[model samples]
Target: MKITISVEQPTGDFQKKLLALLADHADDIEPDATWTKERAERLYLALPTNARRIVKEAADRGGYVSADDLRSGEDSSLRGHSAAIKRAVDRGARDGWWPATLQSPVQAQGPGFGKVVGYLIPEYLVEVFQHAANKPSRDW
Candidate 1:
């Protein structure tokens, strides 16, 4: 059975009991967490500078980076990198580096259909991707 538990500020006893239960099932548990550090690092390493920049931008924004802001007459970093980014993500899935069911960490989102305001990294996943990059980003 698959189980997911969300605990915040768990007590010491609760933590110990959880660990004991997990240890007992360790043999049956397969590593399937999406947005894992290793997987994120691998995928990030596989991407080109432009694609990586897009990821960093979204991550730096704490999830969503605006595409409306042109950089001194330049197009948004996400503008020309979409296809290459998609290919890189697909390759990662095919190579078994990341989970096949997981969608691209960088996603285009907006208020409604046909209106793309920016790419969102997902608040929960920003930290993982940032940790994977392991570097400071330039001003975006």
Candidate 2:
């Protein structure tokens, strides 16, 4: 059987939810194609800088990165970028760059969102997010 869904230039939250439903169901049909590079790229560009860094690191680490692992000599804030990290998906959804219901590229692991121990990028999105994160940004 085959199904065809056509919406005329969908927009708004309802549209977002509907699109998300379709994408989620894609997991059952063909999970690998759910997170395409183009979609990841669009959402990646819409994310904040810190959020992008977190995603890049997760991609590099095969879809899971501890927030503590992100700290470096120059950057001492080792608790992970909570504000930016938490807002990653919302920002993308609000901007209409991606579906609001889509799973986050960076999923924080901790106690009830109180403290993030780490971030997990979906296995399917690992390479897609990596490609998006590595793409050169506008140097203007």
Candidate 3:
């Protein structure tokens, strides 16, 4: 049997959920076509600097990064600029540039249970995000 989904565009939240589901269950899902570096390059050029940076860092680490990681250090680029980072991430996810989780905190075993956090992005999109960094930054 074959199934089809028809929508002009999936909403940002919907896309994020879909991507997360896919990432979490990658072993169960298979694509009809293989993902290629060319396709990755095509997608990476359109992402914002913040998104690119996050992707690059996460890719370098191990394919997953939390918001706390980005903002942990005093000299971190994301330090004191979380709002902008969130916006950039949201935009990128909305546009299907990459997959990211919602900015929310997860409770730990002890201490600071209310810490707000960022979502996790998949490592596959790292190449695209990296390519975006090489592009010149511009303002309108």
lDDT of 2 by residue, 1-140 (tens): 55645465677987989968888887565323255777777767766677778888989889988867877788757454645655665776676555555666677777884667788887877889899888886431
**Cα deviation of 68, candidate 2, in Å:** 1.9
Candidate closest to the true structure, highest lDDT: 1
RMSD of each: 11.3, 5.8, 9.6
Clashes of 2: 0
Q: What stretches of model 2 exceed 4 Å from their correct place?
A: 1-33, 73-75, 78-88, 138-140
TM-score of 3: 0.35
Looking at model 3, which ten-residue stretch has the lowest summed lDDT? 102-111
- For 1-140, candidate 1 gives per-residue lDDT tens digits of 77756565679999999979989989987756577877777777787887777787787778777766423355534455645667877898776666556778888777776656778888899999888777543321
Ranking by TM-score: 2, 1, 3
Evaluate model 1: give its TM-score: 0.63
**Model 2 vs. true fold: TM:** 0.64
Identify the superior model by TM-score, candidate 1 or candidate 3.
1
Clashing pairs in 1: none
Instruction: Show where candidate 1 strays beyond 4 Å.
Output: 1-33, 70-77, 111-115, 136-140
Give the per-residue lDDT digits (tens) of candidate 3, residues 56-82. 565555555666676645654443333
